[model samples]
Target: MSISASPKSRLLITHVLDFNSIFLFKAQVSRQSLGVLRDMKAAIYPITRPTIGRKKIPFRPYNTFPSGLKAEVVTFDE
Candidate 1:
């Protein structure tokens, strides 16, 4: 299953909590689509860490792979 977000949705997802929602959404969709045995992918904008004061704290979850998935992040030439 391929997941995509619109520009408006992407804007809302920039927040830390909203970004975390993406993971939940992914997991739910994966479960529902399991019967089809389709590959799961999200076509969202590159995720940037939110800032606290002048420093950008890391979003550690972004560095790890999703559970039960053998996936990799691929970048394209811009």
Candidate 2:
């Protein structure tokens, strides 16, 4: 099977055969492939969940100024 030029980071056939969670291992995959063990569990390798930081980053104002006086622009990377 062949994959197109799409850059999705989901699992592909190659990843499923041998799973590795270490970022370095996953890096070897092409853009279209995903972490082999992402969906399944195995005895040799434990499935790990992404650790969510329960404590939020302390919010500090980057720059405080009069709202009206500042020229503002916003962009969403999403």
**Considering every candidate listed, which one attains the maximal TM-score?**
2
Q: Which regions in candidate 1 have their CA more than 4 angstroms from the true location?
A: 1-17, 23-60, 66-78
Collision count of model 1: 0
Tens-digit lDDT string for candidate 1 (1-78): 234421111111135564333321111122323423353352243333322112122334665534312232121111
* Clash count per candidate: 0, 1
Per-candidate TM equals 0.15, 0.18
- Candidate 2, residues 1-78, lDDT tens digits: the string is 355332322221223444421111111233223343353434245433432211111112534422311222111111
Candidate lDDT scores, in order, read: 0.27, 0.26
Top lDDT prediction, candidate number: 1
Q: List the residue pairs that clash in candidate 1.
A: none
